[model samples]
Structure formats: structure tokens, C-alpha cells
Target: MVLSDLGRRINAAVSDLSRAPNLDEKAFDSMIKEICAALLSADVNVKLVGNLRKSIREQVKFKDLPPNTNNNTKRRLIQQAVFDHLTHLVDPHAEPYKPKKGKSNVIMFVGLQGAGKTTTCTKLARYYQTRGFKACLVCADTFRAGAYDQLKQNATKAKIPYYGSLTETDPAVVAAAGVARFRKEKFEIIIVDTSGRHQQEADLFAEMVQVQTAIKPDQTIMVLDGTIGQAVESQSTAFKQTADFGAIIITKTDGGAAGGGAISAVAATHTPIIFLGTGEHMMDLERFEPKAFISRLLGYGDMSGLIDHIQSITRDSAAMKETQKHLAEGIFTLRDMKEQITNIMKMGPLSKVAGMIPGLGGMMGGMSDADGTEKLKRMIYIYDSMTAKELESDGKILVEQPTRMTRIAHGSGTSVREVEELLTQHKVMAGIAKNMGQNKQNMQRAQKMMQGPNSKQQAAAMQKRLQSMGGAGRGMPGMGGDLSQMMQMMGQGGGGMPNMAQMQQMMSQMGGGGLGGLGNMFGGGGGGGRGRGR
Candidate 1:
């Protein structure tokens, strides 16, 4: 079974417990059996599975509990026991290697051929670059033809500097030279890509040892193939003998039946799983957390990760401050709208963002990055047609003079109706800006409210306030239509969808309160919070 299948089965078992009118010995045993079956099917070790079952039984054993403990408490303990046991299945509880900020932290990549080691080297550099590190890539894989070319192409595209030799045939020499060059250049993080073989050839292990001795890398990461199933254990063990692996990255985890096996292999080695390769893109690598990973696997969205995504895009305090100044000035310029959309796009695919919401995924569901990117392009094209004065004035020409809208549509090669629609969107946001600028205090208060314990409820109330302030996104094209469709979907599926929390949390991250009206689009986020909807 794949990671997703494991989640599905476990979720079904939990649902069975939640629905049962009575909690009995048979019911508890049935849940345990289901858990064991899921674990075994995922290629987890039979011994580990037996231990998990035994641990759960011991955890819920009633004879050790106080007589006053109720059945509900007993049931909750059983669920907690299962969660705790599952968490330990793959988490080695070892600290991952961390790169020092000011120092040159060298990372060496080692894995079997075709395990995606080269790709991961570039991805790792990009990850560090996004977080403000001066990261560079070095290609030491002389065994793999075109390794330098591949690294060069990725480095050039990311605008990150790189070092490699087209003529170098010795992996150790290449690695040593690259590390020396990057360290002299004052690069903060230097990543070295080493050679690999189809099989664990003696030469392969010897080459790794030679490279390891030469560079003495701060950390050596093993890029494991998640599709290899239970065999990952043996591969990880073999690599462990070659060198000290500080961490492991499981690649091709987007969907692979043996991903569980690959994960469980963490128990076989000293290294912890640090990242998971979810897609082909460099941005697809996610920092792995056992609890959060298990949560998403069970179809529960990852909110903390979503918040981190927003923070990554909005980390520039100065940019957010400028936006706040514009919002406070109550000028919802066309350029401001473009910047908001641009920031959102930079956070990644809209479909993925929608998934962060519990049920709103259906509304913006199945929207690929291509589709979202195209929509962004069209909107920007319209902005490109607008004059500097027009953009700054928030499309006043389109609002006051109908002919200006016509001219823009002809210039943009879009329908006059489309231009009008875009202008209408600006107006909706502008109204929110006006309200927020007028009542910025309440919005700021709401921003702090987010850190409170009942953030979900506070966010919901904030949404209602935004709706009341600006007619709740009524005028935008399909605004009302989408809301009705969403309401219908929620009705069809029992109404506990948690859409409000998802919508509000995201909108609040967008810039707080003035954009709360736009949160109407997602049905949350307007909770008296304000973002830099300048």
C-alpha cells in the first residue's frame, strides 16, 4: 500500500470507532487488526508491526487504569496509542544536520544511480536560496555523463552560481576542486554531487569513501528511492558503511506503493528522513515532519505548512510594510492588485493552496499550475495595457469613462466585458481597502487575535465582519455563483466542512482585513484582519 492508502485505511478505522454506539473489546481489537493489516501491506517489517500491535494493547490495557476512567477516555487512549506507535515507525528521533549561517556548510549527496541524486542537489540549493542563503551547486559525478551540464542548466536557471569540470574524470578530484572554489567565493552553502552506480559495486563504495575523506563534508545526505520498497533497508545499510549519512531524502514520494517501506527503513539506519520529493519541480521538496506527514496522508490538510508557504512569500517585512501604507492610504491601485496576485502565484500552485483548505479544494479543485499561471498571465496582460496614471488611480478611467475600458480591451486583445470584469474586481478590493483604512484599528486587533488559542473561531467572526463591511464579494463575476455552489456542496456532504477556518486563515495571511472582502471568495480570512491590499 502507498502512503495515501495507509492513511485511507487508518482513517476508515477511526471513522468506525467514532460511529460506534458502544466501545467494546471486539471493537478495539478490530481497529488494531485494521491498523496491523495496513502497516504490513505497506511492507513495514513484520516484527515492527507485531511490536506496534503489542504496544497499542499495553497502552489501552484497562486493568492498569483507574476505575473512574470512562469508555470515552479509554477509546481516546486507544487512538492516541495508535498515533504514538505509528509516529515511531519511521522517526529515528535523531537531530538532522543543520548548516551554519555564516560558515561554508558543505553537503555531499550519495545514492544509487537513477535515485535522483543529481536533481536533488539542485533542489536542495534552491531550497536554501529561497530562504536567503547564498547556496551553490558542485557536480562531482564523473561517472554520470552530462552531470555537469544538468547541474549547470539548473544553476543558471535559478541564478545560483555553480562549479564543475567538463574534463574532470575523477569524482574525488572534482569534488575537492569544487569545494575549494566555492569556499573561496564565500558561498554559504556548497552542495557536492557524487557518483553512483546501478548496483553497490565495490568501486562505488570506494569512490564515496575517497570523496568523503577529501572534502570532509559537514553533512552527507543519502537520496533514497521510495519506490524500492523494503529493499531500501539493505541499500541504506550498504551506504551507511560507505560513510556517515547525516540525513536521508526519499525521492519520488508523490505516489509509490513502497514509500512506506522506504520510510520505515529509517529504523535500519542512523539518519533521519529530512525531506520528501513530491514532484519533478525543484520547489516540490517539503521539510518532513512525522505528525504533519501522517496528517496529510490521512487526507487532513497541512495548515502549518500552508502558513509557512505564505510566510515564505511575505517574509519581506519592508514590502509588507509598503503594502500596509498603501492600504492605510485607502488606495487600491491596479498595480497593488497585480502584486498581490504575483505574491500568491510565487507561493506555488493554486490547486495546492486550495488543498490546504479542508473543503474549499472542491471549489478551486483540479486547477493545475498551468491553469493558475495562465489566469495570472491574462490578468497581468490587462494591467500591462493600463497607463501608469490609470493603474495608480485604480483604473478610474475604466470606472468613470466607458471608452477607456474599450481602448484597454482592444489593446489587450481581450473582450470589453473582460476588462470590465477585471475593473469590477478592483472595485471590490477597493471597497474593502476603504473600510480597512477607515477601521484599521479593528483589523490590527484581529491580527493579534490570530495568535490566540481559539484562532479558528476568531477567524470565523472576522469573516462575518468583512462581509458586512463590503457586501462580501457580491459584485465580482461568479462571486455569488461560486458561493452558492460551495454552499450546495457543503449541504450535500454534512455541514462540518471547516471551510471558514481555511478561508480566513489564508486571507489574513494575504494582508489582514481590507482584503477580507476578497476572502469572501474563499469564504474566510476577512475576519477583521488586514493584509497589505495596497
Candidate 2:
């Protein structure tokens, strides 16, 4: 079983238990049995699965519950226990080394051949480069033929600075020279890509030691193939003994059925996994967080990860800044909506973005990326069909004139209903923007605080406030309290804007309609209608 299949099976078991009329120990045990079976099929270690089953049973203790406890309460306890245990199964209670700005942080990569060390090195470099770090790559894999050429091509495509010696036969010599040169140039993040053999031979261990000695790296990361299954344990252990790597990065996570096993095996070794290579794309790497990973795995969505992606992608966009200014004033015009849509397009594939939304993921589970992207493009066409006056208005003028809607539909080559649906989506967001405008002063203050010197401290303080207000389980129903608290947090300058929890609540109100009539397109039993151009 793949990770997605495992997640769906486990989720179905939990959901079945939740819907059971008799919330007794029998049903609970059945759910546990199903979950364990699913995990085992996914290649998760038997001992780990057994421990998880035992832990869930101990935590829930269905028989020990109060006689007056309602089924709802009992269900929540069971679900929470499953979520916590699944999270614990992948968490290595250790923190990865964080690179400091303005300083050279040498990150060394080690793993067996074909584990994707070369590609991952460039990805890591680009990741930091996007985050305002002066990141560069050093290709020191002399054992592998064409390693320098491959690194050069990747680095050139990503536009990240790189240093590699095509003529150097000794990996250590190239690594030392690259690091020394980058340090002299004051590059903040220097990543050294080392050579790997097919097997953990003595020569490979000696080569790794020599490179480590040459670079004296700030952090050493082992790249593991997610398809290695239980073998990940022995492989990681051998590398750990030889290189003492500070962190791990698992590649091919999006492809293999043994991904779950690889994660569990690595966690058993007590070394933190920093990232997972989800795809071959340069932007496919995802930061590893146990809770967020498990949450997304179980189809619950990951708000924090979405926020990080948004921040990383839109950090320097002037258009985004302009939209933020407009949002501060409580104005969300069609142009602003268009800009938001464009940003979503830039974020990545629609399937991946949908998974970050609470209920949207499961709703669009069967829709392919091409279909979703086409749906979004049609909405953009509607915006493009509008006149300048129409785009600048709050979409009320278009509604006042039915002919304008028809004109937009004709011009955009879409149906009148899709045009209307687009307006509906805009209306929902416009209402949120108006509410935000009502609290403009608070939003301004929050923005300033976030951009100020003590921004990190202020952000942490606000996060604590959100958690206090039950932001942790915002995916659950009845989020009105959380929404109000989020607005209040904005008012007090505690947070910059409405968070994922707040956005989820708002999107739920539209029945998942925010993304260019996406709710209508997917929720109305079909893909609705395609434009003439499509």
C-alpha cells in the first residue's frame, strides 16, 4: 500500500467508528485492528504498529470512559489518540541544525548511490535562496561520472551560484576548495554534495570521512530513498555510524509504497528528518513536520505548511504587497481576486494546494491536476473578459447588469453560470475583506509588529494566543469561536491576518467556493462546463 492508500484506509476506519451507533469497546477494537492491518500492509514495522495499537487502546480505554460520556466525546478521544500516535511514530524528538543568516552554514549530503543526493542538494540550495539566503552548491561527488555536469545544469536552471571541479579526482579536495571559496565570498548557506557508492563499502566510509574532515561542515544530512522500506533502518544506521549525519532527507516520497516504512524506520533511529522530496520538480521539497505530515496524510490538511509556502512564494512580490494594502483598506476588487488566483497558480499543482485546505482535498480527491487547473483558468478568463471599470468595482455592477454577465460569458468563452459563480466567490472574499477593513487599524498594527525587530517574538506570542483560543483543531466543525478569536487577535495586533483556521471557516461557509467557483465546479456532481477555448 502507498502512503495515500494507507492514510485513506486508516481514515475510513476512524470515520466508521465515529459513525457507529454503539461506541463500545468492540467497535473501538475493530477500528484499531483495521488501522494496524493497514499500517502493516504499508510496510510499517510490525513492532511499531503493535506499539501504536497498544498505545491507542491505552489512551482511549473505551471501557473506562464515564458512563455519562456522550458518543461525540468518545469519538473525539479516539480520533485524537490515533492522530497523536501516528505523529509519534514519525517524530524523532530532535531538532535539525538551522542555518544562521550572514554566516556560512556548510551542509554536507551523504547517502548511497541513486538516493538523489545531487538533485536534492540543488533543491535545498534553491529553497534557502528563495528565503533571502545567499545559498550556493558545491558538487564534490568525484566518484560519480558527470556529477559536475548534472549539478551545473541544475544550478544553472535554478539560477543558484555553484562551484565544482570537473578535473578534481579527489572529492575532499573539491569540497574543501568550494567551501573555502564560498566562505571567502560570504555565502550564507554552502551545501556540499558528496559521493556515494552502491553499497556501504569500507572505501565509501573512508571517502565520507575524508570529505567531512575537509569541509568540517556545520551540518551533515543523509539522503535516504523512501522506497527502501525496512532496509532504511540498517542503511541509515550504517551512515550514522560512519558520518554521524545531523539530519535526514527522504527522497521519492511521492512515488513509493514503502514511504511509510522508510519514515518509521528513520524515526526509530532518533535522527530528525528535515525535508521530503515529493517530486522531481525544483519546488517539490517539503519541510518535514510530524504533526503536519500526519495531518495531511489523514486528509485533515496542513495550515502551517500552507502558510509557509505562501510566505516563501510571495515574500517579495510587489503585486502581493499591493493586494495586501488593498486588503488592509477592506477592498477586494476583481483585479485583487485575479492576483490571488495567479498566486495560487504559482504555488504549485492544484492537487497539492487542495490538500492544504481542510475539506477541499477530499472533495477534489478524484479530480486530476489538469482538470483543476483548467477550472481555475476559466475563472481567470472571466476576469480577463471584464472591462477595466468592471474589474475595479466590487462585482456589484456586473450583478446589476445581467447583460454584463452575459457579455463576460461570451467574451471569456465560458458559461453565464460560471461567471455568476465567480462573482459569488468574489462576494465571499469581498465580505471577508470588508470585515478586515473594519479592523483596518488592527491590521496595520499587526503588520507593523510582524515587520518590526521583535517580529519572531511577537509572532510566537500571537501563535500562543491562537492555540489558547482552540486554533489547534480548527479543522473540526463549529469554528465560529475560532473565527471571532482570530479577528480579535488581528484587532489587538496579535496576528497579521486571518489564519488558515479562519480561512477554512470562511471557505466552509461558501461550501468550498473561494477558489474561482471551485466549489461549484466540483461540488455540483460534475465539472460543470468548460469554456469554448478549452
Candidate 3:
């Protein structure tokens, strides 16, 4: 039921379109109404959505769509229109990290309290450190007693030099000193961590200007809580107007609402979201991609850093052994299935993962991505609800007995058909699990083929074929599951499939430990915490 809001909207739109006789002006109008209603209800920017609806209406009215366009074609057109509109709202890529014609590249962090600005500063330092930059930290947040100590601790752990003064006087002085020291140390990147403050505070805004003047940072990033919704627009606007914010990093996305509002807020501001803070862990940071982001919002998985996660977490021997077991015995139990799902969920979302595959996203384009994500969540929930007996039995009793199915549906607040669909999906996945060893081998073979003497010829042929086939006709088997696994691999390294399992375990523990307050903190209880800087 996590996707209840988006799901209901998609169903309504599909239903309305299904009833239409053809893709005409009248049908397009009705579709627009459904889309507008859905997007507005989901807290999308009202004016932006309205303008998008207007554009779609005019396009359908004036442009000559293919004759004999059916509901399916219209649905696809609507999707394209929405995608194009949303893409325009996202920030253009900023210049990569390169030293300006100066001593060192200085980056400043600013945001509201508890927005994770301090943590993000450290992460950025580490990110640059990994990229061979000699990064230094500047703790300008003298307001909080432990703020200096905490940042210094992280700096020590990262083996980076840091500068902070104990005085609670002007922050600009401390920042100036930090930059001077970093310059003396011959550091390549100097990151300053400022005290968190609301943009509405005139005093804080004034203090930010002094700090900006003192450090003359190459990039000033506004770090907002991803849980904050459409209000991000105001936050971005305030900071950009005050200090010329170069980018935005939305933190705490791993736990919260869909983070859709944050995405829209960034789009509205035309500021690129540079990074997403997925968890409290230092390594849980990632660069942003608009398409992958949209796909995740629509319930897809991302695979960009999946291979890296796998490399970090899983030993080759372990994967090879599991692969061998699956191929030789061809029996996949609930445990194996759970492992697979957990691994994929870590990469981010199911759809994102599939989209990473060269030819998969286009083929699965019209599939209700939001609905699919919800379905994946439901499947995970059902697994969570199951007793050990039920899981080991391969869901036999649940499938055979209607009474049990009804009980499960009631317990899960899902329809029996939904439960049935989960079972069917499980069966298909179980088969794929058994065949994965072979598929991975084949993929490796293909990779090797591309490196061989006929590489250019084969590449040319493949490109021509893909060009002729277009995006939709390509069939990418098991790509959906591949996507899910990839995300898991990214979150934690060594590919031991800990991403979803760990999250589920953490959730279960949190749920049981009477930390009910945490759920409310995520804005899922009463839904009152709907916007940022409120």
C-alpha cells in the first residue's frame, strides 16, 4: 500500500483511457484531467503540472499523431510528454570537480538544522579524497558545542586535516583561517562546514554572506533533507538568492515519503541535485541521474554503482559457488529468492535497475512503473509476513487454498489476486534464479566477444539492429530482477545481498522496539510533515 497514492492515479488514468474510443482531442482532454489530478494530489508543483497539462493538450490538438492511434498509443504519448516535461525541470550537469585558477577549490555547505549538512561535508571530502584530491575540512559551525569535535572526529577518520576555532564569534573568521591553513597544506579541495540554519533567519542569511565573502568558495551547495517536499523550492530559492548556491544535495531519502517533492523542487529551481544521501552511513552517498531518478520514482531500480557494490561486498568465490549451486541443482528456495530480491532492492528500485540494462527500459516503457514498484514492495511485505514454514514450502499452501489466500490478503490489505500475482512472479523468478549461472556466463561471453577481433563488426551490427528495432521492441529477459539486485549491490559492498535484508531487518527491529516515533518522523503517520522549512 506504500504506492497507494500514485497507484490509484495510474489506475484511474488507465481506466479512463480504456473507455475512450480513440486518441482524439476529447480523449486527450480526459487524460489530462486524470494526470492533473494525480500529480497535484501527489504534491507536484501545481503551476508546473498545469502548464505541462496545457502543453500536452495543445500537442495532441495540433500535432498529427499517427492515424488510428489507440488507447495504448495515447498512453505512451502521455508518458513521453510527462517525461519530457519533467526532464526539463531537472538541473543541467554542473562542471566536474576541477580546480579554478586559484589556490584551492573551496566548497561550502548550508542548510536548515538536522538537514545532515555536517555529514554531507565529510562525505564530499571523502569522495574527493577517493578521487586523488588532497581535501581539507573547515568546521565553521561554532554554535553547537559538539559540532567542532564531531567534524574533527570524522576528519581524523578520513585522515584529512581540519581547522576549527572554539570561539562562538563570527564564523567568517574561522572559515578564513581554515582556507589559509588548507592553502598552506597545499590541499586541492577545501570544504567548509557551516552551522545549519533556516533561510528565513535574516541573521543566518547575513552570516552566510560574510562566510561566502571570506572563503570565496568555488561551489556552494544547499543540503536539504530529502524528506522535505515541495518546500524545497523556497529553500533553494532563498539560498540561491542569498549566496548563489551551485547545487543541492537532498539527504535522508532512504527513509521517508517517495522524495518526489524534493525532485520536483529541484526541477522547479533548475538546480541540479548533485548527490542523494541514502542512509546515515558515510558511504551511502551517490551522484544523481534524472532518468534513473524518475525511473526509481516510477518504481524502477538503478544499476550505476551496482557493480562497484558487488565488487566491494561479495567475494568472487561466494558468487561462483551460489551460481554453481543454482545451475547444477536447479532448485531455488524462498531463501535464495529473498537473497536475490534483497540484493536488487539495494541498487535502488526495480525499474531503475531494468532501465540500466542496454535495451530493457524501452521494452517495459508502458508498464505502470509506480505500480510495479508498489508490487515489489508488496512482494517484500508478503515475504516479511510469512512464517518460516510458508517460505520453505515455496508458497504451496497459499497457492492451493483460497482460505489461506484470503487470510493473507486481509493481513496484507491486498487483494487475493495481488497475492496470486506475487506467487506467479515468485515462480518465474525462482526459475530465473536457477538459470542465472548460465545467463551470467552468457553475459560474460558477450562482453568478451565485444573485446575480440570482430568487436567493431559485431558492435556495428548490434547498433544497426538496435536502431531498427527502436526502444520498445527489445526483449530483456530477467532485466527487472537484474535491476533490483544491482541496487542492493550498490548500497553495501561484497554483494552478499545485505541491502534489502538489512533494511527489512532494521525496519522490523524499529517496528518492534516501540520506536513508533521514528515512523512519524518519516512523515508516513499523520502526513502532517509534508514540506520542508515548515
TM-score of each: 0.71, 0.86, 0.58
> Model 1 reaches what TM-score against the true structure?
0.71
lDDT for model 1 comes to 0.71
Cα RMSD, each candidate: 9.1, 5.6, 12.6
Candidate 2 local lDDT, 284-399, one digit each (tens): 88898887778777777666788788877888899889889898777889899898888888777777787766677766758888877877787788888999999889999988
Q: Please identify model 1 stretches exceeding 4 Å from their true place.
A: 62-79, 311-338, 346-351, 355-534
Best by TM-score: 2
User: Local distance difference test, per candidate?
Assistant: 0.71, 0.78, 0.61
Q: Taking the tens digit of each residue's C-alpha lDDT, what string does model 1 give over 1-534?
A: 237677778878966886678777788899989988988888887888898889888878867788787776766676667666777776788999899898899999998888899888888998888788899998988887888898898888878898888887988999899899999989999999988753449887888899999999999999988787788788888888768788999888766565667766788785688888877877777777775566455444556666666666666656566666898876677878877766767766665565454434444445556755665666676777888888778677677898887776667666676676667667778866765576566455555555578755775676577567653453222222233233322232122222333343444434322333323333321122121122
Alpha-carbon error at 409 in model 1, in Å?
10
Clashes of 2: 0
The collision pairs in model 2 are none
lDDT of 1 at 176: 95
